[model samples]
Structures are given as structure tokens and as C-alpha cells.
Target: MVLAFSTESLNGLCSDDQLELLDAIDHLRLQGIDHYISLPQIIVCGDQSSGKSSVLEAISGVPFPVKSNLCTCFPTELVLRRTPETGVTVSIVPDSSYNSTENGLHKFHEELDGFEGFPDLVEKAKVAMGITTLGKAFSKDRLRVEITGPDRPHLTIIDMPGLIHSETKTQSKTDVRLVRQVVRSYMKQPRSIILAVVSAKNDFANQAVLNFAREVDERGSRTMGVITKPDCLVEGSGSEKAFISLARNNQVNFDLGWHVLKNLDSETQKGSSLLNQRNVEEARFFSRGAWKELPPSMLGINELRKRLSDVLLKQIAFELPSLIREIESGLDESREKLKELGEPRRTYDEQRLQLLQVSQGFQSLVEGSVSGSYDDPFFEDAQSDKGYEQRIRSVIQNMNKEFADEITAHGHRREVGSKSQTPDQNPEYVTREVFLDHVQSMMQRTRGQELPGIFSPLVVADLFRQQSSPWEEIARGHVKKAWDSAVKFLELVIEHVADPSISNSLLEKVIRPALKTLLTDAEVKTAELLKSHHRVHPITYNQEYAETIHFPGSHSREEISNIVRSFFGLSSISNGNQYLNNNNYNLSRLVDNLSKRVEPTTERLAASEALDRMLAYYYIALKRFIDGIAIEVIEQKILVPLSDILSPVAVFKMPAKVADLIAGESWESRSKRQDLTKKIDVLREGLGTCERFVSSRLKDEQNSQQEEAAGEDLDTSDLSVGIPTASDTEEAGVV
Candidate 1:
């Protein structure tokens, strides 16, 4: 039987106001809030017997309501599967009933069933649920039994008042309506997947009972329909196909919400629906022509039970593609309506595709480099270069070049070192400066230098590497191609710096901060994926990568631009607009590359995770921005304008040189029109200072942590140097 969950639609399942409710439920689930509403406390209400107590007995394993006319005089609650180790726990948030006269009565029946000396309860009870009482309430009398479970049993499911009592219309009394409401409210919880037992005989009164079930089953995801008396209704005629039709239709008749268990078999089967569904069908092939007329129970419940061992196992067996498609559709709708930021490029799928190509490409390249003559068709210089050089540089630049102190320190220092020399001083600094000075001395040579840093050893060294491979020297006379590629990158860099809009000062200001922030943020986010337990290894993590998306901020142009500004501050004096656009593009590319390396499953997986992560991070980034702006706002509002504010480290932005190279000569003029090149140079200067402070803070934090971790006699040397210090940086960049 389809179990009737199929007809239920999750459409409009959650209202806007219910978002918080849903979120809260999702939160409880995360916390494993396995809580079920408890009862005497939970008086199930339905007219007459309505099989209410049968549900209670089945769920709680305690019998009640011997017949239809009998009132469970004691108002007893059966306890299911319990022990004494874990205390009985319940949560009761009372429903508002202050104005009702019924609320005035203190309903306590004083052990009417067993309390020998207690008086009967009034219409209502003064006893209430509180921190001290939790949800427990004491009645003067009536049936009340509490069972504690072995472990903290995941929540409680209570069967309250039987449908239609002798004295009350609701299974619960009017005085207990507040309590009933509370129980119903708890059942509505999003994580509380409910299995509501309904009578299958299909009577008008029983149908009303199903209506209540429908009303309570608001969340399509949480409600399931369970028909109890199949033996009476379909008898042996209920074949699997027939039962599935009936089971699947129950939701239609009963109003259960969406989310059908795909598998026909739910967790447990109380009766023997399978005897005929399975064995009867199987037995039909044998000499069962006469036996077909017999009920399996005629033989024995055990034999009937044996007929259903495998067939009765409750499993969700719907086609997975449907579920996946449904989820994806829901995700898309959610994304469009859910959050603040709308990023078309928010997905890492394209990036993942690129990474896949690169990963496979790099492996191929490495194998090619190592290939012996015997290896498959080795070419002296097999690389295709029409666009090969450009693509290579593109990948490297896309890798995001970092200019840590150590990087610049590499070729910085001059041949002449003063006594102030620290072994860690960057050699790049001295050498590059010397090269610059030499060019100036040969100012006559500057006319030919074409570029300010044209003769610099840094460029010369790069030039050399591109020309010679470990295995061969620029075979096929590709020397010009390599030189041309190098020259192209150089031109891109020089033109960007020389742009009139870029002042050395502003360049100094924005360059370091933006780039540093971008790269580091990307790294941190990428690291989060790598850190996920699902990742088998760092490199292999890419194989398992997926993307998620959500909006974090408004789609308003101004608001979005502001987010961009807060994230990638412009470097120029005017802080032109194009720079912002260009920066965004580059940052996106870089973020994508890094993210893909962390998780590179496939197009679909990439899109999903990229979207989720974007939503998560954008929220975080916006929060950071708000905090930062708030600090400034508070400072502005205060009597004393804040003299000090924590300036977060600027992540590495796409370098202007690289951006220029990407733009090409023509793309440069228009692309960098408002670009801030020289301004970024100043940013670099500020970054130097920021780096120093951050480094000091990091060192202090490390030292403090180490000291705390150390014993009284611990040696300083006992602490191993971990992450390289700010000034003392490590070099891991591509050559």
C-alpha cells in the first residue's frame, strides 16, 4: 500500500511566521532534542472509544478503555518501553487559558484509582508546569502512572483522553483543554515525526477522528498515516498492490501532511498485513486453491507472523532521483526567496570544473614530465602554445600570488648588508632595489628599459625558468613564446601601476589590505571544507566537494556595492567604481579556485555546496562588517572619537599587474579607468604596519597559550615553532 503519504504536498508547508518555528525545530534536532509530549498529561480526544486507548496500549503497552461506553475513570496514561535509570522528562509550555472559569478549578482526583486517602480533583488543577515541576502535574486522584526509561529516552509520545467520554465531548475535559493544547503544540514540532494511528473501518465518527489528525499534522514533513485494522476492512483481499493503494490513499482521506516514507514498510507492523500480502501471493502458486478462502489467523498468529518476516520490514523505497529533484527544486525556491545576498557566481561549479581539468591536467603534465622514452608517445615538446602560455599564467595568477614579507624579502636586499642584517631579511628586497638603482644610474638605459622594473633580477629569474625545462631547453624554438608570455605579464603589471588614476600612495593603502583579506578569507573558508570529517585527505577533499547557496544581503545595488567596498576597499584617491567591479571579478575567480580545490565533486554537487557556503560566509562577513561599522558608529557617537580601532588584515586582492595582464592593452585603458593602482601601493605600506601588529599579537597569543600549557619546569624550547611568524614567513608559492 502506498501508505497515503504520496498525495500530501509540502507546498506552503511552512509559512513566513513559521520560519523561526522551523529554524527552532531544526535547532532542536541538531541538539538531538528527542522530546515527546507526555500524557495523563496528554488526554487523547475523540468521540466515544475511537480506538483511542488501543493506540495508547499499542504505543505505551498499557491497556485502557475496556469498551466504547466506559470512561477511563482514572484518566490513566500508559507508559511505553521504560526503565528506572533515566528519569521521566517532559516539557510543557502551557496554553493561554487565564479567562476560562475552568482554569479556576484545581482538578485532582487524589488517586481515585489507587490513592486511598486523597480527595477528588476539582474541575482544574492549580498544579502547574515550571522549572521545578517541569511538565509534571499532580491530581488529587484518577489514573496516573509515570515510567522512566533506561536512558534519557528521546521525548515522549502520549495517548491522552479517549475519544468522546461519558461526561466530556473531548477526550479531555474542558478544564484540561489547556493541557491538550500544549500536547498538540508539542506534536506540531518540525522534528517530531509522528505516526498517527487511524481506524481503517472508515466510519463517519472515525472520519472525524482523522480530521483531528489532519489538523494536528500541519507539517508535511512530520506526519505519517498508520491504518490499524486492515484485517477487518480488506481482509485477505488486501494484496500488496491493493494495500499500497489503500495505504497511500489514507493520507488523502485522513489529511496527513506531505513526506511519504518511500519504502512501503514502516519501522514496525503490529498486525499481520503481510500474511496475505506476501505468503498468500506466494502460496497461490502451490495447492492453495482451497486454502485461499481461509484466514491466516485460522492457522495461528505465529504462522501468520512467519508469513511476513521480510515483506513487512518498513523501508522507504521510492526512486531516489525523484527525491533529489524535489530537494533541488525546493533548494532553488528557498534560495530565491530565503536570504539577503544574491550572487549569480555564488556557485563553485564552474570553478570545480576548472579544478577537475587542472587536477587531471596537472597529473597528466607531471606524468608527462616524468615519462621515459618507452612511455606512451612522448613528445619532445607536446604542449600546444597558441593559448597555452596564457592559460598557464592565468592558473598561476588565479592561484593568487601572495606578497608576504618573506616573498618580497626573497630578492629585496642589496648585495651590501649593514650590521643590522638579520638572517631572515628578504634577499628580494636588496637585490630588487639594487637593480632599480642601477637602472636609474643608467637613466640613458631607461629609454630602452621600457618598463621601470624591466631589468630587475626578479623578472630576469622568471624569464630563465620559462625558457628551460628540467628535461629540455625550449624545444621547437618556443623560446620566443616563453619570452612573449613573460613580456605580456610584465607589460600588464607596468601598465597597471603607471595608470594615472593609481597613485603610489593609494596603491600602498589598498593593495595589501584587500589582497591579504581576500586570500586569507578564501583560505579559511577552504580550510573549513578540508576540516570536514567527510574529507578523507586534504588533496582528496576536492573529490568530495559540494557547493551551497543563499542570499546574505539585499539585492539593492547600493547595498551590494557597499558590501563590496567593505570587503574590497578601493585604492585610488577617488576610489573609482571600475576598480570595485574588477576587484569583485578577480576576487570571485580566486575564491572559486580555492573553494574548488577544497571540494571538487561535480557540477551539481559543486553548485549545491557553493551555494550553502556562500550563504554561510556572506552572513559571517556581513556580521563582521556590521561589527566594524558599529565600532565606528559608536566611536562617532561617543564624546571621544575613537583613536584606536582594530583594523582587520586585508586579504590579498588580485594584483593590478596581474589584472592589467588579464585586461590586455586595450582592456587596460577602459578597465583601469577608475582603478586604483598607485593607491594600492600605499595600501601595501599600511599593510606592512598592520602585519607587524598582527604578528606581534599572534606571537603574544602563542606564548601565552604555551605558558599556560607548560608545567612549572618547562623549557621554552619545549614549544615547537608552529605557524611561521609575521616577519619570519615561509615560502610555498609556485616558482
Candidate 2:
């Protein structure tokens, strides 16, 4: 079937199944059917004169033509199926492989001859098979052999042409063509299975049959191997023993011969034996007309027929389904081949365009990065590929690191996906503790993925690259852009071999995208950090962390400060020696908070408590800063005026529950200063006098008050809210 439609039209006509079949065919061509176990297509094949007939008889246990007459000309299909009464019997018919041809050769195979023709026919068949039937000049009718009866289980055996390799003296083109046509037909069934009949005759070079076999079936592995002529090895001939060594070599060389069966090396089979001296020399063995009275293994004609029939029957059962499948697959493949032959010009153009786009993308990528300059002798080295391979390996290593970090960090380093949550570090130990934690945290971060070292190589190399000399930059731009440009090289490295440390997930997902993202992010973070670098950078740290939290408030401020200096090995910014502020520990609370936050999320719940502790430290420090400032303002500003209006206890009585703590009692140890307390009390009386004075001033200066408020809508409730008492005269103080 030629698929002549445009892609759109083809899409319209194709059901999902057809498209899927097309896809499967495409995949099969690349990987071969080895990817799957196909049902067996057992093709029972042999040459014109080989004992394929007797073999068929023995295995099927049914009478096959015993004569030498070429009766099976066209290919025959014998489907062995089971039924209740018969147990199993083959359903015989001509396959479509025979149907397509109009020649007399179509009816190629016929049951060869009668029992009267047996002895001579068997001898001639042996010779015909000795040389491949391929060179035989026989009339096409001589090639036809009829199908024989074979009982089997869900199997069909396509008993094909006997050994017809090109080396035969009696070979005929018409004979080869007829068999090949049958094979071609078999190929159509998708169920046709081929069996390559190798006689233990000349070592295993009979494998040369496969050269021709491949022309008929691409899946020659699906061909079951039939080691006919197993009797060639006889006790009297010293050469028989030499055949044993040949058998072993055959096993080693052709272990992958077929699909449904392992090749039958006569040497490998149990209970198998070589013929004795008398049988080896005798041209005619004792004769028998039938095999009903024969023993299981042959000493004479009856038993020999029984042996042939039995193995043939078993092999027939094996070959049928595979033969059908092979035929069907070939038919399907031919249809595809026809469609490819008829593909439209526009389709070719579109494919060309797609190819061009891919090529251009590849070219741009290579030119920018991976490809070498004309001057780089390493890239141009003709004598050795070592330099080229090394360059590629280096690019791959760097790429693996780039992608590994991106994935481990979950696409962005700033994101907190793979970090240690509560890293063990003592706040007192400071520098080494924190530094150790950083390294440990980096390692811990590596654990989030299966490949630790391979996936996340230290991209701190990026910083070195950034800080390199200008000449180095120029050199890198020329030689190493492949690693940096990434996507192209990334894809290559991933498909090729890689570091055991690298994860496939990182390559496909992370490294490819991160190179672009990091460049953008670096620019952004740099600009933002420049804005307030002064204020933020000048702050001192309280302390570096030790391996354990030995000083989570375990030590005092002075001790922690000393720890910080000692841990970092920092000298003090001497008081008169120059720094603007005496207080140290100026780093932002957020930075420390983020570092602890960025630690790997511990796997065990036991570490959550430590993370909580780390978070609490940040919260407490920030809280103290705000609370201390708030306390200072309350002591200096609000308490003075409010206290002047009432005694400490009187102030509490003002009745806004919120203000109950607003008096002198709000201060710790307020009683320690009596003068301050006494003044606070006297100020309450003075508040009443000031209220009177303010009222008189307001009465006289009403016009002045109007002038003061003339252009504004500001309310002074806060100003009066703290003033004084409940008398009618006290109204002036409230006002």
C-alpha cells in the first residue's frame, strides 16, 4: 500500500493504529526485533534433495512423500493446530507467497516421491544439499516439493527450498527465483518464520546459506537452524571425531542463529550417536517400508524414518507462527517501502527544511563553542584523535558540573531545595565551624540526587573563570566556549559516555538551561548588591559557628564577640585606629538567617529542632534590636509628659486598660532614683498650672489660635490626651 497522501491527508486517513505501526516500523529498523520477543514463525527450510522429507516425516509422524521426485514446487503453508479428537494436525494450504506469481513455479513444492523412489531419492537429495541448490540448472518443476503431514501445536512450518546457495553445480536461476518469490510471499504474512537448514556437514560454514537467507528474511535470526545430516559422523571414520571440534566452533560462532530455537548441534544433543563402521561403508542400509514397528532411535530404515518424522514434527511446531509473523511483517514493510517510493515533492521539501534548521542550529552552536580554530593543531591532528577526545571530555566534565548543580539546586541556586537544614556548627567556634558547615552543606546538598560528585562538581570553577586574566578570557572564549554555550555540547555529552557522578536527569533538565539563567542572574545580583554595599558590608558578626551549637546563647555577648574575632582570626578595628562605629557585629540578620535556611533539609525529623533553633536566633536578635530602641524612646520621650500629669498609680487609674502600664512603674528599678520619682510627682501638679495658663493664653489669643489653625486641618487630640483632671476648670487643661 503506497501512502501517497500529503501528511495532512495521510493523517486524515491513518487511524491511530496505522500511525503507531509506522512509528513501530521506524523503531524496528533502528533497533531490530531483538528489542521484543516475537511469536515464532517456524519456516522449515531445506534443499531439493536433503532428507528434509524424512525429517518432516519423523517429526510429523505422518507419511510424507518418500520418493526423490520434486513434488513441492510452490511454497506450502501447513498450520499445525490442535483439535479434541486428533490431538494436533497440520492444516495445509499454499501461502500467498505462491499466489502472486503467475508462473508454473508458483505451485513449487509437492510431496517428492513414493516409497519405491526412496533410496535413490534420499541419496540424490543428499548430493543436492551438498552443494547449495543455487547453481543447479534444473527445470523449475524439479525444485517443487509438496507439503507433508505434520501434527503440531499452534504452529506452521513453511518447508522451503533445500540448500540453494550459489555454490551449487546444478543451480538454476528459475529455481532460486521461485524459492525467493515464496520467501518474499512469506515475508508478507508477518507470521512467516524461516528455518535455515544447516547440515552438520561441513563444520558450520553451511552458514553461508544465511547470505542468501538474508535476502529472503531480514530477521534471519528468526530462522530456526536445522542441523540435518547429523549422521555424517560415524565411528569408523576417524574424521567423525574431528567433527566434534567443528561442532564446538559452530556453537561459538553461530549462537545467535535463530529466534524460536537454539541451533541443534548434534554433538550437544543427549542420546545422539554416530553411525557404526558397517553403516558408514554401506551405500544401502537395511530397508523398511514403514516406521510403525521402529525403535525410538534408528538402527534401520523404519527407525530412521521415525527419527526424521519426530524431529521434523517438533521443528514444524516451532516454525509456524514465526513464519506467519515474518510474512505479515514483510508485507507491512513492503507497503511502507512503496509509500516511501511515492512520497510527494513537498514532503521532501519540508523534510529538507527541517534538516536545514537542525543543521543551522548545530552549526551556530559549533561555531560559537565546540569547533576548533584553524590554528589549533590539536583539533587538526591527523595522526592521533587523542587531543580531540580530550577536548570533548573536558567539555563534557564541565557541562556535567554545570547541569548537576542546577538540578541539585532545583534550577536556581538561590532557591532552597537541596540544602542542609540544621547543619552542625558551634556559634562560638565561628570561622572553621561555619566554613566546615559550608563545605559539609555543599556535600549534603549533593545527596539530594543519586549522583553526588558527578552531578555536582564544584562550579566554583566558574568564579575562577570569571576572575581570569583578559588574555585567558580571550583564550577561553576561543577554546572553551563549547562548555559554556552548553546546549549543543550538553546534548552530545549526555548521549555519549559520562562521569559516573553525572545524573541523566541533570543533563536533560538542569545544565542545559542553567548556563543562560546563571549569566542573567549574576548580572542582576551584582547590580542590586552594589546599591548598599557599604552599609551592609561594614557590619561585624557576633561569632562564627563551631561544628556544634556550643554557643546558642551558651556564651555571653562579650564571649561570643571574642569567639567571633578568634574564630575568624580577625584583628579588632582599633577604637582610635579608625572605624566609624564602636559596636561590631554589623552583618544583616537576614544573611545569617538565609544561610541557615539554605542548609540541606535534613532527612530525619530530629534535625528540625536544630533548624528551629537557628531560626529563633535570627528572630531573637532582630526582636532585641527593635525592642531596645522602643524602650529607649519610651524612657526619654513619652514618660516625662505623661508622668507630669499624674502620680504613678494615678496614671494607671486613667482607665484605658492599654495605658495601665504607662506610669513610673513601667520602668524597672524606678524606685532607685527618688529625685526622679519626686520630680515626676511634682510635675503632675505643674501640669494643672500649665493647663490654666494654656486656657488663659487661648482665651486671649483666640484670633491667634485661629491664625495658627487658619490654613491647616491637623487634630491635636494626642496633644490634649495626656493633659489632666475632671474639674470644670480642668476642661481647659484637656482642651
Candidate 3:
């Protein structure tokens, strides 16, 4: 039934101030602020053919096309505004799930002065949204119908596509999921008051809308149950009684309670005065039947309209404060995004300046990181690996300590019994005696014209080279690890200081090549440091070497004596006097000759001496190598160059064309900046609107209190003296 437009029909339902508040929110919604923040509104949702569109039509007094077998395929938003004249405008708000440009959904708009062509407009909207019986079954796009008339209440009600129970030939499983997704998206908004429509012809338990409502608003704080088609139930039947109980809020109770309405039957819909006939039949059916027990507030479309209006107002009031806070937060985030994108670098000069700025920031952060001065906010998350990686000094120090420990534990080729071995000692180690036996074999093979006690000095160099072989691989690995950390830190700094487009170009054109060069230089320097020990003769003047050298105490005098006897093929004598008394030898002379003999024992002693010198030299060289890697290669070659890789001087020396290529904005960056700028503007305006609303509300409250105080001080005698009270002024039409 089409409701008439007149000034007296909808006036006094809400105060002018409340209407202003609703209008302000509506204005923000139209400006697309609702995409960033949820706005307060009534959303009608239910299963297919659940009379949801009927409820919307009853409240809005606009003819929403409804059929017995057909169901809504898209969301329809009815925005009713109170104005002096009647007007209507139809438009399409393209669903965010689809690209408006590709779909051409943003091009649909129509204006009308009346509702005569609304049904045809609805058909056109469906076609525009690509909804058809054989083709698309549903859409996420919204068909917005703004109705402005003198009698229309200031409200907005959205009628969403009904939920599907299962898939059919026309509606696939994808359509069912899409419809649920669309319904749940609206219900989940904190500011939306859910009007869950349930048809009385079906069992409430079978309907899924209430379950969805409870899922989103579990407490039912913002959900109201609306039972439609009450006249369809037979009087005094079990179904009618159950619906009556539901209308009384006894069955399936909600915090917002339940409402019931009777929509126009098919026969009544074809006749004139459809609104009057439907209202009369609904009232007559409820006035004397079991439904009479229900509250009047829960019956009829008029009371439902008032309840929805009040519910929306309270919801808006309850959410406005947090809404303002959300807008402020959104504004801050957009500004930060814009700042990260930086100023547009269109010209060569501007691009050069941008690169210089980025270079300055990169150099500053690198210097702080390399020097162990982690005072920057970026280094605050020290517990995280990213933060730890950025602290170059700490990472390098840990790496150096680990390198030294590895060398100490695995550096020696043999384990001497004289010294205790580390827990992590290399498994390839052999006893000193076994090592010396191998050394003696080598010595016999390389025996020069020299005496048995003396051997080639090259033997010591060979032993040292083999002992320190693991050093080069270990040092190279450590260097590579430190280089990786430096690269990670550089990438993080670039990302922080510049846009993605600029950062990617800078890394490709400048930072990567520079780092590659530094890595090669560091590796070469590390190899050179190892070469000095590998190719050259053992050389160390440190006094610590002399202190470290000690004879192998595990060797006994008997072992040496046995070796000497075996080498000369001599038998053991019963007494030492037998050899001394021989005419060929004198006692003192024989002892001196035995001590000076170039026997196998002399060769063993030479090997032992060589081993002791090698051990001492190894200790000294290990310390020197560790220091050289940490200081000369890691610090000087890699880290030191990193701090100046993107320095101001380097940026200044760069050609303008190269700087432009590295720092110029790309299409994505420009689009992102533009989007952020528009968002910032919308948020600022929304923030101002909320602030003005709050200020005006507070001023009104203060004025109300002051007037009440004045009224309280009034007396009969004061009125007689021609002093007008607030009530008196209002009665005289002066306020």
C-alpha cells in the first residue's frame, strides 16, 4: 500500500535534534565514510520468501516489489528523509568485492519525483547488477532508493538478499555462500541494528536468520525479531499459538524483543486502499484472538517504525563516541601511509632531492648500527630477531666469539696428552706419540746430509699449515654470515626511509652492486690473511709463544732408552761397569759418547721439539687471525663501507638521470598517495562533524539544566510581578 505524503503524518515522532544527528551520519555514509567506519542503520535479513521486503515496505511506505515465489536477489537500501516536498532518487552502490570500473556498476543512477516507476526501476537495477533467473542468482551490490517526502520518517532500512537453504539448478553452491557472506558482513557491523524477519508459515527453528543474528550479536543487544504473515496461520492452531507466544517475547527471546506484522494478501494487494485493508484485517485478527494477549507495542507496522527509529537513535548515541575515536585513528593511519609514500618526485631535480634525503637517512641509521649506538626507536625491539640483526656490533661480537671458540676446539691436528682437550675437540685428533711416529717417518724420508737429530725446517711449516687448515673455511663462513646480516639491515632501512618503488629501484641500481663489491673485497682480504699463515714459514716473536711451549711429560726415560738400544742392536748388560771397564772405553768418556750419539732417540727428540714449537705458534696465530677477521675484514671492508654506501656525498655525486631512475614515483605509488589523501580529507570532515555534534549536545544539556534550575526557583508571587518562567514563556510561544 502506498502511503500519502503530508506534513502532519510523521512530525513529532523524533525531535529536530535527533533528526539532525541521523542526517549527519547519513551524510557521512553518502560520502563513503561508512567504508572506513560502521554507521548506525537498520538491516532487514531473513530466509528466502520470508516477507523481509514486506516489512521494509511497511516501514518506508514505499512499494517494494514482492512475489510469492520470487525472492530478493540483491540488497535494497531505502533512505527515508523528512522534507517539505516529495522526491526520489535511485542509484547503485557498487559492491567492494567487485571492481566498479570493470563491472560498470557505478554508472547506474536515476531520479524521479514519485514512486510511479519504482517497480520498473527495480527491474532495471536487477538487470544492471546482472541478476537474472537463468544467469546470476545474487549480487553483493546495493540498489539505493532515497525517498524524501513530508510524511516520511528520518530513517534508513536495508533489505538484504534472503539466505538460501541449498543449491538449485539456477542457484549454485557459490550463490548460497555469497548470500551468506553478504548478510553476515552487514550483521557484523557494530552499529547496525539487525531486523531479523521470520515468517510465521515456517517453524522458527528452521529459519537460519536468527542463528546468524545471534552469531554476530550474541547477546541480542542490537537484534530484533520480526514475525511476518501472522494471518497465514489458522486461528487456534498450534502454529498460531506458538507465534503468539513469540510475539509476546516468551519463545526465543531477544534483548530488543519481538515484533509482529501482517502483510497484504494477494487478493487485498490487487484492490484499492491496500494499506487500510491490511491494517484493518491485522487489527481485527489480533484484537480478539490468542494474539490479543500480545503487547500493542509489538504489533502493527506503525509501532515497529517507532521502535526501529528509537533503536537506531540509541545505537547511534551509544556508538558515536567510539566512532569518533575510530575516525581519528583512521585519519592518523592514512597520514602515516601518505608520509611513507613521500612527496611526488616527477622532475629530475625533485627526484634527486628525494634520493639525497633517503641516502641521508640510510647513512645515519647505518652509522648508528655499526657503532653500537642503538638509541634509535627502530632498535627498541631487541628481543626480536629483526631488531637483533640491525644491531651490527652485537651480532658481530657474538660471531667473533663463536669463531674463536670453534678455532680453539678444532684448530689442532693432534691432541697431546700433556694438555686437556676441549669437550668439542675434533674427532680427527691423534695422540702426540702417534703424531710424532708419523713425523719421524717423514723425517727419515726427507733426511738431508745433516745429522739424525736435525731435520729440514720445512717440516715445521708443513705441520703448521695442516693444523690451521680449518681456519680459512671457518673464517670465510663467519665473514659471509656477517655480510648477510648487513644486507638484511640495509634492506630494512631502505624500506623504512623510502617508498617501495623507490626502494626497489635503489636496491637494484645502487645498493646491490655496492654490497657485492664490498663482499668480494672482504672475502679477498680474509683469504690474504689466511695466506700469510698457510704459505709462509712459522714466525711469531710474541713472548707468549715461549711461555706456551712445554715438553711432552708423558714420554718416560725407559721408552727413550728402549728406542736407543733397539736402534744400535745392543743387549742389556747385567751391570753398567761391564761396558765402562772395557779397554776400548773410559767411564766418563763412554757416558759422554752415549749422550752425543746420533741414534733413533735423537731423531725422536727433534720431532718432539718441532711439535712443541708448532703448538706454541698455533696459539699465537689463532689469536692474531681472529682479530684480523673481526677488525680488518668484517669491520674495515664490509661494515665500514656499508655505513658510507648511501652517504650524502655519494648521493650528491650521482648523476641527475640516475637519481631520477632510482627515486621517481611509480604509478602504484601515485595511486596509493591519491587514495590516502582522499581518505584523510573524508576522515577530517567526519571528525569535525562528530566534534560539532558532541559540543552542541553538551551545550543543550547545560542549557536544559539551567532552565530547570530557574523553574525550581519560581514562586506564585514572582509570576504575579510579571516575571515569566520557562513554562510560561513556552505557553506564550516566546521560546
Give candidates' CA RMSD values in order. 35.6, 42.2, 10.3
Residue lDDT tens for model 3, 399-444:
8899888777776666655565556545255676788887787777
Q: Which lDDT values do the candidates have, in the order given?
A: 0.31, 0.35, 0.77
Off by over 4 Å in 2: 1-39, 84-152, 165-171, 180-194, 201-203, 206-208, 213-221, 234-242, 249-252, 255-735
TM-score of each: 0.24, 0.25, 0.67
**TM-score ranking from best to worst?**
3, 2, 1
Mind giving the per-residue lDDT tens digits that candidate 2 earns over 271-305? 11212222332224223212112222323323332
Could you say which candidate leads in lDDT? 3
Q: How far is 368's C-alpha from truth in model 3 (Å)?
A: 5.2
Candidate 2 vs candidate 3, lDDT winner: 3
- Which runs in model 1 stand beyond 4 Å of their true positions? 1-47, 65-96, 99-144, 149-155, 162-193, 204-206, 216-219, 234-244, 250-735
lDDT at residue 507 of model 3 (Cα atoms): 90
> What is the C-alpha lDDT profile of model 1 across 316-353, one tens digit per residue?
11111222233334434434432211111112443233
Angstrom error of the Cα, residue 327, model 3: value is 4.7
